[model samples]
Target: MASRPRPPPPAEEQVGQSLSLGEFQNVQSLSLSAARMILHAMINHRQKGSKDGSIAMPETETLNKTLDYLELFARFKDQETTQSVENILGNYDELDTFEKSQLASLCCVEVDEAKTLIPSLANKISDADLKDLLDQIIAKRQFMDS
Candidate 1:
């Protein structure tokens, strides 16, 4: 009888192509592909058009502003992430509001010791700001749930 060697397990990374800065939580692995995919699904999923659809690129100003915002957001976050929020948000701006908001939530959690972060977050965001965001989010959720 011959003995066989056991196969090693996959590295503690590259689990899903659907993770983002705000969504990384207790991440056992931080696959770059998974992170990119998550951001794409969250932000750029909407930019896809019909079979003959056109791809409209944003103006330089909008792109830059968006980039700045995402970057600033990531800086404020306090978690370790596979990719920068700027990278994800900049690449995924084509997604719809719901998806964008979801992605934002995922990448910028206020919980302790998450795998990802967004500095100066709203939970740590002002009470008034938090209230507004919560109300709006709740309203949006109600609309979506309905």
Candidate 2:
């Protein structure tokens, strides 16, 4: 009998311990705030460019739901705060893009909570450093609120 060819690796989208994002592995990941900003900008641009002063592109139910969810859950609202959070996360060379986005979006108050929520973060950063990062994020959020 002829020898069989080796099978390809599975393309599961795993984010725990280590990332197995499959097709998205090399793609840039955005935080909830960033995603919200981009979507809002696109919507606004489309609306502004319409000849009839109406939405150039029809809004789908999925788009409306996504916008609503982002409005409710996105931690940083304004562009300045969003940029600050991005900058803070970007400074951490230890974290991958996905990890940084997860950290920014979740905005966990404690190191343990962050690690518990983002298991991959457990071995990536020290508890004290993670706590400091969390503090910075919280402080930015507080400043935005006030």
Top TM-score model: 2
Q: Global lDDT of each model?
A: 0.39, 0.92
Q: Which stretches of model 1 miss by more than 4 angstroms?
A: 1-103, 106-119, 122-124
Residues 1-146, model 2: lDDT tens digits = 59888889778998798777898898899999999999999888888879777648888999999999999999999999999999999999988899999999999999989988888898889999999999999999999999
Q: In model 1, what lDDT does residue 106 have? A: 50
User: How many residue pairs clash per model?
Assistant: 20, 0
lDDT of 1 by residue, 1-146 (tens): 38888777544532233333333333333223333445445445445542237664443676557545554443222222223432343353333233334444453233321212322232333445443443443444344436
> What local lDDT does model 2 show for residue 133?
98
Error of 2 at 138 (Å): 0.3
Q: What is the lDDT of residue 55 in candidate 2?
A: 49
